[model samples]
Target chain A: MGKRFTLYTTIFLLIGIGLAPVLYMFIRSLFVDGGFSLRNYETLFQSDREWRLLFNSLSLAGATTLITVLLGVPLGTLFAKTDLPLKRFFTILFVIPLLVPSYILAIAWFYCLGRSGIVAMIFNADVGILTSNLLFGFAGTLFVMVSALLPVVIILTITYLRMVNPNLEEAAMLYGPWTTVLRKITIPLITPGIALAGLIVFILTLGEFGVPSFLRFDVYPVESFTQFSAFYNFNTATAAAIPLGLITLVVLIIERFFLRKKTFIFRTMGSEKKMLVVPLGKSKPFFMVAVSILVFILVIIPLCILIHKSVSISAYTEAFIRSIGSIMRSLVYASIGATCLVVFGFFLGYILARKAIRLFYAVDSIAIFLFALPGAVIGIGLSGLWNTPGTNFIYASMCIIIFGYIAQYTALGERIMAATFSHVPHSMEEAAQNVGAGWFRRLSGILIPLAKRGMVATWFIGFIFCLRDIGITMMVYPPAHDTLPVRIFTLMANSPEDVISAMCVIMIMITLLPLGGLGLVKRYIK
Target chain B: MVAKMIVKIDNVSKSYNKHSVIKAISLDIEKGERVVILGPSGCGKTTLLRIVAGFIHPNQGKVIIDGNVVADNGKCIIEPENRQVGMVFQDLALWPHMSNYKNLEFGLKAKKIPKMETRKRIDEIFEKVQMTQFKNVYPGELSGGQQQRIALARALVMQPKILLMDEPLSSLDADLSLTLRKEILRLQEELAITLIYVTHDREEAFSLASRIVVMESGKIQKTGTVSEITAYLSGL
Candidate 1:
């Protein structure tokens, strides 16, 4: 029961647990051409192909961050704290873009902009004009990524905005007008939240594979995939992962540094829960129209196109049947993975909350390392780890995919659980035990029950990450097995826009229906 | 008549490496005694109380509950749940996720109390606390005073031989704290439970305790009747 012994044991356990895959990768990266060498890094730089791909990936991520912030802030603000007409409707509509996979959006855009496309049809007389030209390459990639990631920025911004106390705004108004208040008080308060949104989007876009890969664009993830899957060069692929991983690490470091600065105060705590709504007045109609257009372009159009494409009788039946089995496999694996994640998340969260468990900084650093590692690196590292002699359990089994899911998604679940756990006072659990509640009883009846909302949030995050995941799944999936995302990605390259559209529509429908039901239940029950 | 030594602390010295927090302190509690640990902030009162409840272990001493040594130097024998001690926190640490009923039932069920017995106990406790109407309400839905009573009922339902509290009313408003202080003393008397209360409020301690143990800077300053302690503390 010595505190030092417990602290050391915990530190070793966490380090070993987190460092296993990375250590495996490091060992593999060392072995080059029958001997250990720095050949991987040397070759990684010498090869222009991989370097270009990394460059393209970073550029696209930066572009996406820029475009996402440009659009998401105004839109998130317009929805949450405004008296604009049909605000709730627009709020739901704007978030629908998140439901549709980015690859599906690419296919939809291809349908509308192809030579015999809808845009071409509408501008038949203006065909071949520069302004009416089809978007592809960097421009098309930027457009699609912005549309894909905008919802992320919007959700984060809106949540933080909702958390800001209106009293601060009221106080600011005493000094000046609404615009000045927004510039001085509101903007400063929301900056950290906005930065968090931007950091998340940047990391996500950096690792993005579906949009860039579909558009014939070379990015780091795609390049890493090509190096391993096409050329079978594991070292080269890992080398490709390093630069992007380093970039993500830098961003994470900066985020943590600024977050620790104590520049921001959480004014929302102990304040009113009801958010203040700014009246739109004459701008209400204009804002409504603009928001409606955004939803149409982002959510509705691609969805409608996919549905139209899927209506063919034979193709629809075949794809639907294939999708059914895929859905089952994904659900089983993801559910098991989510369960494991929640268990670990809750224990660690409780330890941090109650025991004030030391080694948090080291534990957190290791857990989040994978967050910055592109899925390609995870896939490669996993394959290398489990494919070695006598350790082939993960090589062909569903376990590899599950392991990848855990590594990629545990950080998200932990973050969610940690945020909620911090709000709970440890004294409560102590009090329960003071009442003769055993550890299990305290956890089951008191701690777990008190932290249910957080647990639910953890589950939701795990579920969403599992559902939308394509990068790791693609890298590790056994041949002849296809998840929904895999099926959609394959259809992207060969099938017409309609077929891609049709599959997207079904996927979104499956994802959204349960989510909508859950939202409703949460509203009424909790 | 022989007084039952319900709990005993023998040379309980708590330290972190070289820095001793509670230095060689020994105390004993008789059955149904109301003992207040009076201390300035950062004094060793909380640490000593925590050691008795098995939340913490003393670095150089032993804690005996019901004549059994639960914690000794380099030998912590009992986990907190096995201590059969009820604790009320300074913040009235009610389980926010559970209703008053579930919170009360949790401890009993954990000890494998029969379902029927558990229900009976919960009902009786609810009646005792005058919170039967709010049994189904969560901690968030209850007023602070209501929550304070529920927390008390939760601990009492376990029929703990001793109760431990760490400034249980410190977070409440002055008016509410004053009202709850009376409720606590009344409950202690009715339940006839040994109560170890920790607080920095001299007046609150005086009103609720038969004996006050004043602490300063992680050491026991004095232990006596409320009037004796007040006179002693004022002389300092």
Candidate 2:
């Protein structure tokens, strides 16, 4: 009875806070000012500009998904299933682009390929056609987005590959070479996982606001933001968001269908053997070079360019001094928000893990829907819901920003926690219960201790996401409540190149520091 | 003289999504008796054991342990902790995060045993299992036989009136299985507890059972002594 109460409370609270804004937006789009009407949506369909924005969003997402799958699947398989040299180091480097905010990556590319960039400076050449034409349009947006999102495919694919039963692979190897074995045995087994990863990347890219916004590529999120912020047309902005939200919802449903039957099976069983690693043989060096070059292009070059541009510590100091308030606010708000997410996520995860409630799939779908809603849409919805005439206390405080963070990133926390919880056998807790440990004792002594690593991981991921958020913060932040991402984004149009670069480098450092600390702790413990 | 009844499973039936797994099964167990539930895989032997241990609730009837109504017809359940039952799972289910000693100590501490009494009880069980030297080691660091011993020690330390084991030696090699089976028999005899064990292994069932309940398709086909079971098997 107590457990049921907790589960219902968590589900209701998550729906109330995390999902209500989007629900409000959807309902609001159906009405104009006071009465029920579809004028906003009608106007949305009537405008060619809106249609073009929608096309740009879909095309970018589709192209990014295709490119990511091409690069990520084979590389992920190689790293996970073959004897790739320095696999750990390369995997870490490949994932660096994912950790850096998308806008930061876009800015790095801009600095590297812009007219007065390093290449132009070194060659004393007019690369305006390449920089101005190529780097500021669809091509630059696709490139930046792919680099940032490819890790989703690679990481998830590697996980699925690891989960493929080794016995199946070994049996296939008896009949054919490793390549044939992978095709017949491994790939088919993990196809659902790969497809799920692809769909996630598709939805993420579709809803992405940062890279497109930074590169001046007109997409739905950017259009939605312009409608709300520039034109003060909340109704049109809400309507614009509906198409993107619906697309994301459709993709999320597809992902859910793929995940329903297979999610628990991918969990590592104690009896299952480790993944088989075939020797790379003579192609080892070629594989190593390929991975190294990819990492250099994706991770090392952008970072080096940022470092080169921010050579003066004085520039960093100036940026830091100017944005100290935003930086501090970012840390405080993100920490509070992440802590809340971890708490709520733990209960939500427990419900899913134990199937403690009926309609769990509905709860899961809601989480995914909220997560997949474009940040700009969520931003508009939050303001619409909270920015009331008399609710200034919440609207004018940091509460709104923190609420946005929780609504956006609790899904991430839930995902991490649910995965962790799946590995824990119900029998372990039952064993504890049979030995006369009550619920709290069993939980504290067994489940929490067992799941501590996962909890820590969820917290860190939530923290990083909150720290790097921009769109929702931009829309909801009170005066004097700017976060680091919003501050840097605002300054990019007018700040000196050195200061902008310095701030980007600082953001990278801030993100990397926690990751580095976690790595060190893991090594020491191991 | 007939032994006193310690457990009575009265017309217990269980189902998953309305596909019945345990079909109105009833059994009476006496104190100090070793009752082995022998069945093929998927015959609901483990489910029966769990229902008695209060890990599961039956759909049609009641489980009475020590004259107390523990569970009834899917409506009321005495939680596993309050049942004072000790179970050794097939996979051992030893908490991987703790040392072997801590695993044993957890239950004793949960029963609110004092620090000194808990330490003494844990030490005694560790000594009985000949695992005293490795008490501080985590289960992952232990050999299979040693880990099996730790699982036994963890259950014995609980000092419950009944001990339920579900194919606990199934994962071990033949030699290790023989050794652990002997250890289990010794523990059962020494503890003088009511034992309800589930196993599919014929030799294990024959060796450990004071009475063997043979089940097929969630129905008991026979309940008899070893010789009677042997006779029944030969007739089949």
Candidate 3:
């Protein structure tokens, strides 16, 4: 009985803290001037411009999804199944784009191909084709967004590919060619994974704010930000965000339906069999060249452009000196947010993994829904909930930003924890129970020690996400207390090109520090 | 009448990172013979069976199935498909996404059998196994004994010249294992196919084998009839 009470209390606390802002926004949308009203929503729908913004967002997301799948599927297959040269290096190169902020990619592309870019200066001619309006609009947004999001598809596809029973392929091999076996058996088995990855990319692209805002394209998230920050109309901003949240919910429902009855536990007890590597034969060179070009476009060119533009060390030093406060604030806030997220996520993940509490699946789904929500929408919700006169402490402090990070990223930590917990046999816990160990004792002695690696990974990922976030922080950050991303976004419009480039370089360095440290630690452990 | 050889393993050896799992083993299987290779776990029984099935290449020898060389000295000279062999894995390895009927039909389709003939074979096998009622069900939906029947039916439906079983009934309870062992014996007799069964259970090996080959530490210790194996065990 005490355990049940504790479980319910934890659930309610998580929901209250994580989802209050969205709920507040929903209630606020239904009321105005202390009376029940839908006037804001009605007005939002009545505008054709709003419909255009919605169309733009959907189209961009669709284009990004298509391009991401086209690039990611073949690449994922190559990495997972073939003996590609320097495979590990290429995998890391492909994933770097995802780690770097999307807006930074947008900025890098602009520096490389904008109206007065290096290409125009090099040719001593007007490169109108390269500098056309397309570079600042849909085409540019599609390019940057696909580059930023393709890693999600590749990584998820590789994971699913690894999980496929190799014996299935060997069994098929007993009656057919490898090609026929893969086509008839392997692809069909992994189609669900590919589709899910594509859907996730689609939703992420729809919610993306930074790239579109930088590339001068008008999407709903950017419009929502404008409604709140530019027009100071909280009602319109909240109303604008509702459609996005609803669309995301519908997609989440579709995902759940598609994944129904499928066991998603990542098995850890089985013998670690190496996946069969198909020799690429003469096509190896072709793949190598193609991959090299891809790496050049995705990773090399962006960093080169940033380095070229930030040639002045004085500019870098000045920018670092000026934004040191925001930089420190970002690290501190992200660390706190990541720690809280991992702790709460461990409890929620344990509940869902063990089915410890009734209706816990609903809690899991809600967390996922919150994670998938657009950052701008989350920002609007948080402001609507906490920006009132009575909530001055939270609204005027860093807690709101940290709260936003927790709400958006706890799902990631929960998933990692759940996967880790699923691998731990229940009999071990039962054995501890038989020994008279209480819940806390079992958790600390057994579960936490076993899941320490997963917890650390969750914390690292949550930290990176919180550090890279711009849209939510932009909306909820207290006045005069900006994070690096917020500072970069605010300064982009007015700062000199060199200073901004230097700041982007600094941002990239800071991002890579933890990742590089992790790499070193892994090597030492090995 | 001359006895025809269905499988020939000549000087086969295999190693993983210099630790030999199969050391210079040789065996010959005749058509319609139930030859059970009995050994403890990690004793190379599965590896030897896999070599005959063309799933693994021998490091220093040749595997010829029905007069055609399938693998030679670490090279798969002819791939598994052309060898016309069916294997039942220890885990059953039934494709969870496929129905029992579809699973049986997959090999036939891969072999390019005609659609009508494929249906006919599948129906006949399902009827023989008394699993026709469960043909539309997935492997996950079936009972363990039912899944065992379906796995056997899937292997038999291919109509391969040779059938290999690797502890396929190890996971079931004692009663179920006994029943399935009897069913498999009955099927082997009815189909008149070559059989290479691997297991560590002494009773299972004795019950299923026309001739039993005892092995330990990657070397065959004895090869004889079931009574001979029993006598050897009694002497030990």
Candidate 4:
């Protein structure tokens, strides 16, 4: 295919499957009784309870952002730029919670802290009851959200830190101690990346649905989901989601204007020096103990609780018997969704990184904007745009969930692929073109071959995201075709705790299958 | 007459993962001398320079800087900052985030040099380097030649007893390298600083060094005056 045709087709699909539905929802939200109106929004914000919900959303987002950045920066620097031992093991351990869904973590925390929990078995019933009370509130939600999103900041920080030319830090070290050099030179350079991480966490927490809803917190996204699913009020759902959408847009706009050139660039120009690590010397053991303690408290305890809860063979047998189809569905749907996301994301990423079109920046902003919007909004928007009789094929079938995945997660693939594509020298394409190769030929023979590892990584990330995704999948799965995550949510109400915990364990294992497989493949390749 | 000894490396050696990069090589530098260590790439010239500057500790032996044992056996007894050494790295690691003025002010401020003196020193260095007009400009905005000059100025503004240059002009074109070499020679004379430079350029060494040390395979092959090294290389 020609460049222009392929690009326009990508744009059309992006709009058709993603933007158009959202635009339709916004338009429908503006009209009531066949006249243009703002009454849905007015009704949404008029009540004191709604304001309290807004407060809850803002506080949760704000607190998550603040604590994650505060904790993430030092931890990232420790892992990336210091002589802390077992760095790789610690990195993988810390990132495990991120791969699991947030609500699964909430369930794990609930099992550990609920009345009939491990504390009751080990300590006493009263302590378990008090801990249960603590776990079912804002504090619990914030803790889980922090655990889920903290990896985002650390990964970004490590990336930014690796790109910094070590000579700069070395130069600073000549005049001052490592602490001063870090404070004055290293942190200042990577602050833009830190800001970007903070922005992402804030938007994610603001739009988070699964954690708050499971914990019974009154956040705006939960209200949006409750309104649409409970009352089937599409207008009020869209109205309730508007604030998060607007907040995402506004935050994204500021991020684009300020951090676009800084945070997203794959390489720093002219500073391709290697990283230098600080020798911890006598403090090595101190820092090692500190990090191990942190990992134990944050990642190990909850996971151990889940494992302990699901120790019975009957729980696994019953869980597998009930949800075997959903597990298989999760695998199949996630695979298909991941493949589709990567292909479309490749072209969209090409536009963003290479600026193939004049409006390339706008294309990038739109994808990310959609990604950052609460997944519930995208789900409702997909349903509203497709639920009509003419579109029952999509609304009533598996296509709806896949479409929701594309609309919500194309940005993840797009962002990752854009970074991958940016590192391939554009001159290679120019040389191929000079030799009479067409755009499609150059892409297939050169770009795709060169970025094979990156594409694999992008696909893996997409699969993991789709597998653990509850926000979009829960909102839009067909009546009888629920994925494992959505099944977990639906089953949580009346099912035995052991069954839920077993399913959760199954969820984590299925997600880790690809990771472990990829690791083995990489070792085999080596 | 013998000059005062400023830097002495006593049987220093360094290795990475049991692969030796610097063997038992020893050298000494008197105050106010321009000594150039010339060698091929991967011959441990840069490693030895880093050892003397207290950035790297040799596996065996000590480094004495200005009459103090800054590094002994495998420990840096005195840190790099307290050793009063200024360096122009091979990559010219000028702070890209800061303007030239801030770059010049950084070392002085770290040493707790007073604000009035910091301003005075930066102004003096900027004037000396003919970069006064561009003091407020960042390093990225400057040309290759201009950044080289700023790197030199950043090092010199510390007013240290010793200066180390690790092929600071290798990235520039021949003409700019020659120009910066002459500038470096002039500043070394005016400041009467002990200059320890490492490079592979024979002509750069012959032109700038009062004494030359030729090294290969992590050992010193010869140490002599410029003309003697010229003869040694010619015979080789």
Report the TM-score of chain B alone for all candidates.
0.97, 0.97, 0.98, 0.98
DockQ of each: 0.65, 0.74, 0.01, 0.01
TM-score of chain A of each: 0.91, 0.96, 0.96, 0.98
For every model shown, what is its TM-score relative to the native structure?
Answer: 0.89, 0.93, 0.69, 0.69
Instruction: Determine the iRMS, in angstroms, of model 1.
Output: 1.6
Question: Looking at candidate 2, what TM-score does chain B attain?
Answer: 0.97
Worst 10 residues of 4 chain B by lDDT: B103-112
lDDT of each: 0.78, 0.86, 0.84, 0.87
Residue A264, candidate 4: C-alpha displacement in angstroms: 7.4
Model 4 global lDDT (CA atoms, 0 to 1): 0.87
- Better candidate by DockQ, 2 or 3: 2
**What is the C-alpha lDDT profile of model 2 across B1-236, one tens digit per residue?**
97799999999999999799999998999999999999899999999999988877788899999999999889556888888778899999989999998899889888999998898989889989998999899999999899889988888898998999999989889998988889889989988988999999989999899999999888888999988988987798
Query: What's the candidate order when arranged by decreasing TM-score?
Result: 2, 1, 4, 3
lDDT of 3 by residue, A1-526 (tens): 3456666776776676678888888888888899999999999999999999999999999999999998998888888888998987888888987886799988888877887777767764368456746679999999999999999989987887888778777889999976787788776777777888888898889889999998889999999999999998988999999999999999999889865434243222123676777788888999999999998998889888988899897988988987999999988998998898788788888888888876989989988998999988888888888878999899899999988888888899888888888876654454233223356655665568768888988888888999899878999998977999888888988888788888888888888898899889989999
Question: Which residue segments of model 4 deviate by more than 4 Å?
Answer: A261-270, B1-236
Q: Write the per-residue lDDT of candidate 2 for residues A392-489, one digit (tens) a residue.
A: 79889998888888788878888888878888998888889888888778778998898888889888898888888877888788899998888899
Worst 10 residues of 4 chain A by lDDT: A428-437
- How large a fraction of the reference contact set does each model reproduce? 0.87, 0.83, 0.00, 0.00
Question: Model 3: residues >4 Å from true position, as ranges?
Answer: A1-6, A128-132, A262-272, B1-236
Candidate 1 residues B1-236, lDDT tens each?
99999998888898887888898898888998999999888888888888988878888888899988899894779888788888877687777667788888777877889999999999998998889999898888988889889988988899888998888888789999888888888888998899999998988999999988888877777889988998998898
